[model samples]
Target chain A: MRDVAIIGAGMIPFGRRDEDTLMDMLAYASLKALDDAGLGDKSVDAVYVGNMGGGMLQRQTAIASSLVDRLNLMPAAAETVENGPASGGSAVKNGLLAVASGYYDYVLVVGGEKMREVTGWRATDFVATMTHPQAEYPYGITLPGMAGMFTRLYMEKYGVTREHLLAISLKNQEMGTLNPYAHVEMALDRGGIFDSPHAIVNNPTSADPLHLYDLCPVSDGAAALILCPLEMAKKLAKPPILIAGFGQATDTQTLQERDDPTDLKAVTLAAQKAFEMAKLKPGDIHVAELHDAFTILEIAESEHVGFFKKGEGGKAAAAGKTRLGGQMPINISGGLKARGHPVGATGVAQVVDIVFQLRHELPKNRQVQKAENGLTVNFGGFGNNVLAFVLRRVQS
Target chain B: MKKEIAITAYKCKKCGKLHYPYHDRCLACKSREFEQIKPQGNAKLLTYTAIFNLPWGFDQRFLILGVAEFENKIKAMGQIKADSVDQLKVGMKMKPSWEPIRVQYGEDVYGLKFEPME
Candidate 1:
């Protein structure tokens, strides 16, 4: 099989984005990537659009085909991938395989979601559709509701405190201030969000044990990457980032059905598989972007992905071990906590950020010094469907 | 309203693993044959949450959700009923019962709910 390499990465600022349609957001990111690749008039061979709610939120289907036409990349093979919040990661996985198998020369992968166009309640409902219809949805369970329950279990079993959660919230949001495209760029203050009596009013509880800041905001944005065979990337303007290895795994549709829901077994399995394929251990990773849909997730996923031992992830975060320049440097892109989760866009956006880090293109403050290898974990559907990727920079 | 919490579970004929919500095949053994069984008696709550953000059809100002482990390796998610949020705790014994949880599509929906075991 041919090796797959990323040549260009692009993303739009994630926020309310009231004016842009989902297609428009997708096209803008795609064009940026194409321009970055210096492709000029060289159109892509295939386009894979990762989207979760275009049909439900935008009332538009056949999005991949629509995006291809919109981008004037007609006749390029087009398909849409949907795997809950991991849709973007799944799309990139498919793109990687397509290029690796020699079936496609140039592949364009983009993920975008326009959730702010609808009411927050509607968007919540749209995401919950991934849950078991009879077992979960009928009970009025939402993603935040699920994460809150997960956090409670983690706390009970692992001794993770609200203080640990607050650390992730404060760190990610503060880091968000450095990223031009982060949704919530303002740094959070402990007094306003936690310490003071007005904290309750300022950061009302969305789910018990999880205040508003613990949860990622509903956002609208898009991110894209251009993929080609490693040999082809050598001719590109930017240094190529090889898709070293990837893994995807699924758990039971319902979280309760798992042997140990708090274990996040899928995460462990996926990361293990990716590491094995990459011939690299978790300790070898220089920086990481974990799916921090909820603050607890950043902690839990860090452990599940083997950055820390079980029950030590929260402690690691509390000690500032997950921050930039720290030992592990997790979520240096502000993560879903402050970067804003546009569901479909999160997975691809994660890879794009890692690509930037590996290329040493991020600003000094945001960049991991001499970053060589990066990891990404895009979680979906309460840990039911998850995708992980190991990327390494191709040194000249 | 009389709420009857009758949960249908399936024990894989090959692996003997039980699925609470029920699946067509056994995830462990890939066995398609299964026998339907009812999860009985009380279970221990694994964890819970009080969700202040209600869904589209849920009218409750805040809803308590819990996951409980039942007999024969069965696990389920249901509403947790209590007088005060303080009453709910992980590892506490809970009894599953059917309760009116929401009104959706202009119809009352009933589902499994958990309460402190009597």
Candidate 2:
């Protein structure tokens, strides 16, 4: 595969945009990315969108075609990629492949979800569709409930404490406060987590061991990125972020079939592949964006991807190792927990943050100083599918 | 009418693997040869979720229960009509039971659920 580079990245603020339609948000982000790249809509050879619930949310199918029409890129091939919450990452991967394979000179990748427009109960149903339809969905295993189960087991098996989970939230919120685009940027203390007004009102105990604050909010937003071959990328307005390594893997969809729920083998394998391809080690990475849909996920993911030792992620967080300005900053965008999880838009948003940090364009407060290398890990449906990408700043 | 909770599964004649919530083809061997096999013995609850919120078309009657390795190593999710969320715990023993999930569009759909084993 030819070397592919990210020429431009753009995102709408991660939060509830009740006034904007899904297409409106996508258009905004895509236009911004195109303009940033000094390209026009006609330059895009194809478009790949990551959307999981256009059908459930708005009863809108054929979303790819709709985007193509709305963007006025009629001649360009348009497709929608869905892999549960990992939709964003998968779409970005496809766009990377398109550019790498020389199939297109330039490709547009966008992820958007208008979740808050639907009723909360309906939103639950839409998210539940990620599970086995015949078994899990029929019984009602929402994502939070599954995370709750995982959290309880991790605590019992690994001695992870509830306070550890709370600490994860507190730290992410601190990072989120530094992030201008984060959905919930307000900082909170451990006591405030369980007793805060937000907790009392919106975050009632949805599941045992997981309060509202411990979970990622249902949000609506969009993120977009422009991909091109290495030769063309250097000509763009901003410094190019090279796709150094990319890897993806899948596992059994049913959680029971997995040998160990505590160990995300798919994530481990994907990360290893990415690191090997990049010829870089975990220590070489300066920054990271992990899929932290829940607090426990951040802990589990940090360990699974070799950032911290197993069962030591929580302690590392307690020690502030993963915080900004620490050994390796994580979720500087507040993560899904605070940045808001718009499902399809999450993966692209992670890449956007990486681009900003690598370009030294991020607000000084959230920026990681001299961030030259970055990684993004996007997992679909509780580890059923995972995609990992490593990006490096191209030295002029 | 109080009915005893039973665990039902389908065994593939080709791979000799058991599948929950019967299917036409065996997931293991991808074979059509199968027979209904009642999973014997009880299952340990690997993990569970107490859903305080119910989705649309679901009754506000019970908490959503997601159990792993239940009834022949099958993962299942269903409405668990237990007395309280405290009654649910990871590693707790459970028995499979069939209950009416909901009447969707005037059709009653029955699904397999798990209740705490005393």
In model 1, which regions exceed 4 Å deviation?
B1-3, B71-73
DockQ of each two-chain model: 0.75, 0.58
Candidate 1 C-alpha lDDT tens digits along A240-270 = 9999989989888887777787889889888
Worst 10 residues of 2 chain A by lDDT: A190-199
lDDT of 2: 0.82
Model 2 lDDT tens row, B5-118: 444667788888876666677767779987777654556777776766667777674475756455456555555657777887777777766767667789876776667785
Against the hidden reference, what TM-scores do the models get?
A: 0.97, 0.92
Fraction of true contacts kept, per model?
0.72, 0.65
Q: For all candidates listed, what's the TM-score of chain B alone? A: 0.88, 0.68
- For model 1, name the residue pairs that clash: none
Report the number of the highest-lDDT candidate.
1
